[model samples]
Target: MSTTSTPDNLELATTAREMADQAPAGSLEKAVAGSVAITCATTRTYQEAIDVLGGIQPVEVRRPAIEFLERLAVAAR
Candidate 1:
């Protein structure tokens, strides 16, 4: 895949790198781990977690969280 370092892409990349630094090793494999744990550890089902996440977070944050939850659900199936 080819990527152009557009300003938006660069910014996103930098932010992702910063966030990655804050996470433990193997975190990329566990990107959805936190949401899964939260859903499992609580009474929330995956759909409920996806719906509720948007209400709790900003749109930018919620969008990715929901997407991650969706991808997790697909992987589970």
Candidate 2:
């Protein structure tokens, strides 16, 4: 399998890293938010790279970001 990173994903990762760094301490709320953002960024990077490979892949690739985002949304509730 091959993997390639895209500029958009890199930007997302950068933004997520920034958000994580600035997140408030000790609060479950903040932690969840930060975690979600980070997850999304990481997921995007992974997905884009995997997509470039153009081969059969695990089902996880189809929904990691969505699943993580949903979890994060629910946690925020």
Candidate 3:
């Protein structure tokens, strides 16, 4: 499988790297904090993108719903 990093994936990786950099020496807190940072960064990116799009109309909404219904009917045959 090919490995590629999307923007959100890149952000998560970057957050993990920063956490590694700041982790305390020989402490369990370091691992816990690093995990929390990665989770928070990934969640924040997903939430922010969702929030931005939640208010906008999709391009498909500009078209009549009947058009999609008709297409679906044909595809189902």
The superposed Cα distance between candidate 1 and the true structure at residue 43, in angstroms, equals 3.3
User: Where is model 3 more than 4 Å wrong at Cα?
Assistant: 1-7, 33-77
Judge candidate 2 at residue 62 and give its lDDT. 30
Per-residue lDDT over 1-77 for candidate 3, one digit per residue giving the tens place of the 0 to 100 score: 11121234345435444655686875544444344344435454434423333333433332322232223223323
Give TM-scores for every candidate, taking all chains together and pairing residue i with residue i. 0.46, 0.34, 0.29
What is candidate 2's lDDT per residue for 28-53, written digit by digit as tens?
Answer: 43454354455546555545433432
lDDT for every model? 0.44, 0.44, 0.39
Global fold similarity of model 1 (TM-score): 0.46
- lDDT string, candidate 1, 1-77, tens digits: 11221223233333334444566876542343354344434433444444566563334455665565554445334
The ten-residue window of minimal lDDT in model 3 covers 64-73
Model 2 TM-score is: 0.34
Better of 1 and 2 by TM-score: 1
- Residue 56 error for model 3, in Å? 39
RMSD of each: 13.1, 10.0, 18.5
